[model samples]
Target: METFDLSRLTDFDFEAVCKDLFEEELGVRLELFAAGADGGVDLRHLSSAGESLVVQCKHWHRSGRAKLIEHVENTEAAKVAKLKPQRYILATSASLTKGAKDKLFEILQPYVKTPSDIYGKEEIDALLRKRDHIVRRHLRLWLTSASVLNSLLAKNVVTRSQALAEEFDGTLRTYAVNPSYDRALELLESRHVCVIAGIPGIGKTTLSQVLSAHYMAMGYELVEISEDSDEANHLWNDELNQVYYYDDFLGQTTFDEKLAKNEDSRLLSLMKRVSRSPNKRFILTTREYILAQARQRYERLDRHSFDVHTCVIDLSDYTYQARASILYNHVYNSPLPQTVKQSFAEKRVYRPIIQHRNFNPRIIAVTLAESGLLSGHHESLSDDIVANLEDPYRIWDHIVRNQLGETDVKLLKLILTFMSDIRLDDLQELWMELGEPLRELRKALGVLDGTMLRSMHQYGAVHVGFHNPSVRDFLVNYVQSDIGEVTSLISMVRRFEQLETLWLIFPAPGGGPMAETYKRRRDQLEQVASMVFHAEPVNLRNSRHGKNYVRRAWLCLEMGLDLESEVIRELALEAASDADTILNASESTDLHAFFQTLARHKTSRGEEIMFDCISWAVEWIMGDLSDWNLIEEAEDFLRSIEHYDPGIEVSEALARLDSVRDDYAESAFEDWAQTHRDPVFSGSEMKEVIDHYKAIGSTDPFDMSEYDNVLQRLDEYDAGHETPFAAPRKDSAAGLAWNEVREVQSMMQTLRESSD
Candidate 1:
């Protein structure tokens, strides 16, 4: 008979095994109590034929014989005496000596029918062998076949899976296992091909690994993606049940059609084969957008081919409970002190974390990890989480500013401009541009090997890019400073110039946007607005730099940075004449200051540039006709521009702005009065509202029927349905929002009755 390894059983599993063993071996049905709180009795056999017995189990596989005897005597004895059953029995997984058994009998003499009733490791092992099915049922977790282990080893899946599992082992212990895991298992069991799709970092890959580990532990052969496609073809001869895992199999974050044709087709072929073969399962993960792109570009990889077999779970489906549990897992397992961990586990602490806009598993893990590093910052930790949540670049900003060496920082900046398509040779050239020796360049590249830059096989050769898209995103937005006469902004601008050289140096090939080179070019332009706005103002004395500033100024305006864009606009105009004026300008430059410089223009070219600056400013200000001050500001700039070269375009545009501003102001007030029916406007405020329309050379031309609802509400108030001085919206539940409605109705009535 084979001996059982009771040490391999979890505490819960041990209790379960005991329940089954007693029912099967003794032919006595047993009742189990709640697991951890099972006070003393784990199994109860209640029947007239069996004299009502209570069995207590000690799953102390690691305890010494002396400790086991002590527990049986003191704890088990007291509980058995309290229960006062007709017979008492103690069961334990501990291997006991003769002296220990004698001591336990002496301790429990009064409680049990006999000391022989106590069953130790030998008896339990005998029961396990007599009922072999019981052992198999309870100890299945340890029953993996040697062939499955060999298969995992052959594919090198053992090492990689172990590393990934350990990375999350601590956190997974606390993770309230998501229901989707079971749902995924069921789908894969029936269909054999499960595609777990979601946004990046939303647990697709994590879920895949979890399922992979689960099925692998269930004695399935593990087949993984290989560099050689021939290995997938060899899997056709497999006889055992197989589980194949291909993470990011379709593509990384987004799909590239060329890569789909060259590489992903092999995986697709393997999946098709798996669908037809018995006892085979295929599990893959991809970003939702990437999957969509793949389906569109590669017809052979059509999702319709495996329609019912696919399962998609996304962030949108995560409930508050699920999100909170995910956060709790990381926070509980974080390396923070015990007290800190307890505080973080509090409902109040994690409540905000779940409700936060950036609440996701990836962010939760990163935030908790970063929080541990930022000691004594509990008060501001939530705020910091919010800031970094809004802009994930902040996390990267923290890393780059604090972690990277000087050479690494320079290399990172150059690589950011290159985006993901950064070539080794180009990196060498860009690194050399810093005037560093060839040896120093090689040393810098060596340092970046595993941290940020990674090797990617594409375009028929190996190339280097960011390890992931997030790293590139962070590095591109991040700016580091050094103590120097020049601002870091000017240095960043020079970097952009270097990026321009890359385009001429290596023109991108024609393809879709997902292509690496195309993405790099796209990211360069995409980051320009943020880069310019984030950088400090540079003295634009040179005409070329002035043009550059002017270009960015317009781009900022287009980006809805109205106030900042205008500030840069005026600075660029001043820098055209004297760059010192830009450095001299105060933070709060008024509308008069904006036009004052235009009056001092000497040459027509200078006047033209200044006029163009004023024109752009007025256009932006007048774009939104609601700002009363912008109309007055445009009037002032128009008056100043007349002294230089005020043409029909300027005069007509200014006249149009004046007309629109007056009309917009009157209409805006009317709309405000209608929306805000509050009766809080003082007598002077009402008179001011009337006089304001008159000053704009227009009467209150709005129709009074729009106030019908407010009038009806006022009638309700006057009819004593509500008090005149009732609290705001006191009758709201009664369907009368009297405060604002009454107020607006009174104002409109007073305006019509009162003469202007």
Candidate 2:
């Protein structure tokens, strides 16, 4: 008897296997964590759907489900028994014995409300999808097993190459979110280990995305080095078939162990391959920190595989072209909003809050966006970039030189935390909460709120969200060495204010709270509310070029554009068709307003709002959906996504299974056959047998061929007859529908009982 060993598997291969398989069959995805199996469950799926099934893969050499019954008690012990999935599916690569099955069934029988034969699958499915889905996806990702003992040794690691190639090609579609040009030539020609570093929110990722698209356009066979998967390892050993991407390598660290392997590490291996291959091109994107790790080498084929290279493009100051792009990319390209359009033409001297720093299109875009000064925002050559930009190096050096005290660090945290747009009044309470010295708080606060932080701060107070999206990431990483005692203090403040929203404010879902606040704050508000009198959109619907701005306005609001609730929501709905599916609702400032706009669009556009409806359904599945109507629409939208996946037929079957035969199922099945492919019958011979059974009304059919065979079943149609299982009554809607032969069993059972 050998023991099972799953620890031999890597996270990536196991998770991918589970994601594609378990979710397909069970609608549950599992996530596997590296450490700490709670109780006996090594994998988990967090779900709201009340039904959960604790699955135990019985790896027993020879087993009984009666022995498996021990795991059932585990689910109950964990207090998840009630929400337990309908079937305690004892899935195994092993077989079960009849005696063991009987014992397990006996144990579960006491808890069973009705015979398993009579149960409606609806309750089970709802719980699986609605409540247990997240947990399932998570668990599958974590615990899906591969048979290592029988695993084949690779003659050539072809699968990794293929998967990587697929992943690389797949990123081309993502270019819709971020665009690039001639990326292959750029990477291939770069002379040194080119560094492309930008401040946070500076669109470095965009540059990488664009570069991928460029290589694809130039006939380069693209290979995506999956962050850390066995498949990726195999990819390195097999082929340097094409250009490879080390894109976002630093973004996730969990895969670092796999990446560290020498030959197994795809990036290092690809580097060697390309250095040797003729005219080879390789593209890499990393934050400067990761970039620092390499020898900053140039010219390869070091059995080192480097190719024709040029100097890395160090794009400085939002070049006029970049500023123009900021203006153009974010503004209305369609039916433009007039009021929003006019403001961009106003020639105000563009002074960067973080002046004189190297600027990217995003910083300029975000600043103009956050300030709600889109149209009036202007650029000037005379504007001093060097003077205005806070030299982060200099500021940190100064603080370090002064032996920056506790107050200085605490004040720095508060300032950075609230750099977006909170009031001085808000800061006062935060100040006391942290218990920092007042003078120190005030002094650092001034610098942070001042030009010292540059474009970092909007108008002193934080933008007011879960955290400062832009700088919070910066502070967490960089402040570890400098700005002493900062992150620990910031973490404490964050505990006091779990979310960055106002403590007193609690807006209800729809409209009441916001409308009330509108009246109360209409007069006294200082930041954005003050600007209500003259709201100018970054995008306008009027001019030829500005027509796009109106559409752009909606996108801006979606991507953290600060705007009045009504304006942003309306804009979002107006151009919702073009919005990215990945656009999150949490990013929206006023969710209700966005929903209201959705409601209005639903009312006005009806079926034309397909894309928005699809977006809503995806959001719905993620548990972010609120409206009941949204759920209804999601059912319809599922039909739409159905068109995209081959599995739609199965989903439709599942949907049909949801109903007890009613006019809906009849109509649904009609529509399904009319609109999509139909389900498969058992077999030609079984089908013929079923037809014969149908021909002789109230006649007995032969016992089903096999235990798993449906035709072999002999459940009684009515209770008067005794059988192994009860026959299904016509679902409340669909009348009893067992074949006529099943009815004969009922009559026979009745006759036998009467004679007794």
Candidate 3:
């Protein structure tokens, strides 16, 4: 007889299983009460309409049919008679005969109206089959075959890409608690297509692999789609009750390619078939920009590929907690020395990793991997962390520098100058244009190896690009050891008149940290801009002008150089649609001056254009408006634009920020400050504070300098009392003495400060 083998579950496990089965299968949420003090009711089910249910789980698996009935009658019936629940359930592990179930109901009389309430072993088996996922999750020894997943994929001629499954088994097994996992699981249950999308190295592929493992554990068959056109088609033959896994279904290899691939239409057709079949799930992963570009370029593929029901698991949805979990998972599981691991538990050690905007899973993984090779000193660890956060590309640069040759380096620089993935045939032409012979070109590619350069077939043409976007960034700014020769070669293929060429090389738009490597070369960027501006004086109004205009504006904005009238005025036009360019060009200190420039342009250009410009600028700059200093800056900038536009959104977002300025417990901030040895509020906490304030109504809080000083002093006090993980400060005795004097002076200062 096929059975659930009820002996495998303990009394507590039986109660918990009953809770899951009732909640998931019956759609009734049953609350499992305390084990010993459940008042004869192990599970309580309350219904809003009226009748509530009280359930008892008797794990009498060892008792046969006659013994189960006797056990229930002697103990359970007496307990239930006292309580008198509206709907009573006797859920037991032991199999009961039909006559025994009828007799139990009769013993209960009116309390148990139906014999169905007295569940037996046969009924438990049916419920187990319906909610088997719950059972599979609880019992490790439950028979869910990994081979069942393997057998789903049909044999075909197209070769499979490297799975990286074995390489990343540890990461997947210990996957952090991200909210997206539940969302992904829920979507996969109902929707046919669930696309996991994110920026490069942000764990999109890893997430897809983890989800595949999850489905495999759930007894769903797994089928991997091949990159080859015919092979991808050959593998999808109405495989029911399966999870079809496709990684990088939309290629990230080339930006210039119009179509994702001719093969994608067929893949979409397969997805359509999956959608129609209720039992199948189709999950894929792709970079965000690649998917965006594909939607823009291919109408048929997009139209058939997605619906209102399609689920997209995007990395942008990751909150600070989720990001912290990613960092924590990697650091906690790493084979670092015990002392280093202990230090990581300190707030100061992990806080920076959580706070960095460039904080990425790949960067964290690589940095920690390299940490294992180094001596576990605090100085070395701190330096490594700071270096990776500041210049993540340096990690890739280290790998490339040790692996590649001189010819390979030259070829990479040449590719970096192009700024886009080049077709392999077109690359050969560019090499010939550089006066390099065909044989030398082949030699250069051979020396470059697959680690640094990746070759992929998109459509029918072969495309070559850097293996990672960070690698491309590294090559562009710092890999200029042979710059003079490379510059000469670039000048031959393209004229200096196209300043957009230089503009395209800078990865980030607003002179962000990514562009810091090139900021020192501001003079070079300026010279190119001047040459282009002089050569094509009348070309300012054309579409080509936007790229060069933004680039010149960035140099002026970052370097504090005087902006030309034409560039500033035209940039305002762009800012009406692209406010990010203006915000990115200026750092936090320069925001007032940057906004003043925009206000001047808004005054010249009429209210409609300027209002849109101010709207976008406000949206961009107000990201940190919760800070007291930034609020003051925002006030000044808003006054500059007040004559031309009202700036309602900007004012509302700011007004909302001012309401809860002192909302947090200063003592907690002081505690964290003392541990971190830094007075500044962390970026993560600042974001939370901003979000909290923004969600509430505005308030007219006291405009007191002492309020700000209170925050600063708390930091100072914390710093004065340094503990472990904090770099020690010398003058603790003096600080303690000053602290007493400051407390007395604070009352008088607060009155004066408030009056001022």
Candidate 4:
């Protein structure tokens, strides 16, 4: 078929061809009119503001191939002609052939027509695909007309879609588990606000996002509203409220803590407004239990014949399908052993697929990609780049100190200090027991349970959470200088001991630990086999109290208490069972259990359980384990507690532990030295840090830095000349956030330096 040029047709048909091409791709429609009628230009285009290049196509396509050249030549001669329109496009259906393209370029070039390469081959083909299409020769003749091509440069036509790049990720799979997927699809197909709730890791949040994305793509308006961000306003102006995701909102707090009720009121009003509209729609995500408890204020979700629905998605059953899905997601994208996947798939050996707390798709992707677990998979695409997710500790630091204004930064330090898969009872008890510094700290941060608490053990419902391990590692390792602390307490203590060992390389600090004096301390430590690890926990005080007796048991266990395994296990059981000290006492129990189980089965009648037997025989002689007394002269009595007095003296105990601070990281010692060294920090920052600490664990405020390993890391890091101002977030309930105040501070610093 020969391509058409506008000149071959009557003005009416030429306008029709232009309209057809414009509407096909740009969704544009234009009107035909005489030259003099003007308003908003001759041709207009629709684009979401700031982006359209609207154009007015003119000239002709017809049997004027020869005369059209004469007209073009004549128009060039009248360079100053006033009759031309402001922006005229001489577009033609016949795409300029490679040969003709050169000739037109020369003839149009000398005249400064700014040749509008506006016509695409597809558009030309579309126009010429039908009957009465202007022939190719006529198309070229029309485009060459001097009246049209000359005035084309100033025009444009913009379309909305072209301006915005597709920012959505497409290759990944997103799924909502069954029964619920079935229910949700019904709700969506009919357009409903679905309220979903379940225990942590049951996939409520993921389902909300996926549903919202799916329906929104299907042309339903969807928004994600939350306490974390004001996404609710996104749907406010719409009369056609289609679907919405209000995530993690519980009823407003009765009191003003971190969030004021005013914002909640505003949100409530917005939700109501959306509901009142005949076309309003939404999906509410919150602890339904909490919502149900609230006295009815806003309309009940089921108020209508109800386009809305409510459902709880619990994963307790772990149906084979769900288990398989979870397993595939984990190992398919994880760095686990190949046999792990094989075992899971074969179903020959039942392997309990441990669900990582980070059940979101991104984390799953990261876990799989980083572990290179997809290596043997028969069908799996190579993983996308693994994003370095923000470290939860660092984000938490931003939250508590930067956002919340509770600068003591204790709650985070407490968590960082006392961690390792912990039981829920032990966690709560420690929060209640040793909460001297952390008590107020926890309340201030609003860790009020639920989202902040997580289950670490295979859900006997026993829980433990200290942020994701990766986030914690980031704070302690990647941004060490910024945090100036490792959240891991044991690690901090080891580092401190290391620093002290290094300092020991120098002559004992003046009169301190005179080579012989410190050596005696070393000898005393050596006398106890548990001290073999250099961190031997031996009770030096008289063993009078039950707690001290347990400590002695722990010491024996650590020292290869072969004979005393049963005794230690029995004793450690109470401590472990004592919700108050389990987190801080689990190591002893685990060590005790290991030996006790071994001794019970392996001890032949003639073979002696030396360590266990000795400890038990000794315990028999001491009628009361807590009956140890201390001599008045003992200044440092933590060790002597079991042998002498078990009670810890407030200041004196701190002073001795203060001395031990030298054994930690040099940075810690330096932070302590410089902090106390600065008369003010000792009076304030140090006081606050410790007070917050004591609130979390029941230790003295001053003793906070002593007890929390992370605090020591932060201190050492601070003393090491790292940025001490930033700390971990105290609460993970809200997504960690940071904004301009600090950025501007940094900016000013830069500006000031530039001025200098």
Best by TM-score: 1
Question: What local lDDT score does residue 675 receive in model 3, on the 0 to 100 scale?
Answer: 52
By lDDT, rank the candidates, best first: 3, 1, 4, 2
Give the winner by TM-score: 2 or 3.
3
In order, the Cα lDDT scores of the candidates are 0.51, 0.34, 0.53, 0.35
Candidate 2 per-residue lDDT over residues 1-756, each given as its tens digit: 112222222222222223333444567765433211233332345577755444332232233334445754444334334435454433332234554455545555433333331111222223334433322232211112122111111223322333333332322211121112333333454431222443454555455544543333333344444333233334442223334554544331111111221222234434433443433345565554333333231111122332233223334434443343334333322123433433333233233322234644434433433322222323321132222134323323433235445564555455443313334455555676566556766676554442223322222333221122344444433444432333243243332121121211222223433334333432222222222212332111111121222223323233222223544344344445544432433222122223323433334453355445444434444343222222223343344354433234436533642332233223322332333232232122233334433665422323323323343221211121211221112231011111101121121121111100
Worst ten in a row by lDDT for model 1:
747-756
lDDT of 4 by residue, 521-638 (tens): 3323233222223242211111111232333334333322333334333343333233333223222222232233324334342123323332332222222212111111121122
Question: For candidate 1, lDDT tens digit of each residue in 1-756?
Answer: 446556544343455667777777668878765322444666788887756778776777776677777666656677667778776777778887777777876777666667677778888888776764554343222232232234355554333444333433332343334556656767776666888877656777677766665566555656664233345556534456567777766544234212311234455545655655546678887777777776665444563465565667765546565665465445434565545544543445556666776555765555566663333455556555656667677766766667657776666655554423545654565456557677875776686665566654433444566655566545433432222201222244334333232222232222322234324334343454344443433221111122233333322322222222334334344443443332222211222334443444345665676656555544544454444433444554455455544656567777797567557545654554565454442222233344456677665453455535544544443343211221112121111111111121121121111100
Off by over 4 Å in 1: 1-151, 154-177, 226-231, 234-236, 257-260, 302-306, 315-359, 362-371, 374-756
lDDT of 1 at 72: 62
- lDDT at 648, model 3: 70
TM-score list, all predictions:
0.47, 0.27, 0.41, 0.27
Q: How far is candidate 1 from the true structure (C-alpha RMSD, Å)?
A: 24.7
lDDT for each residue of candidate 3 in 1-756, tens digit (9 for 90 to 100): 334655544344455567767666557777665433445677788788777788777766665667767756776688788878788887877777888888888887667869988777678878876654555544311322233223323333212422233333554433443555556656666665688877777777666766665655444556666343344345544433466777666654333222222344445555554555455667787777777776664444555445443445555555555565566556545666646654654556666776677777777776776664333444477457667878877776665566556666767766665544667876776677667788877887775545567776544566777755656656654634444643443453332223334433433344444354445444555454444432322111111222333334433332332323344334335433555554443332233334444444434454565566566556655656544435544554555444545647766755654443454424334434355555466433433333434456432232233345445554454344322221112231111221211121121111111100
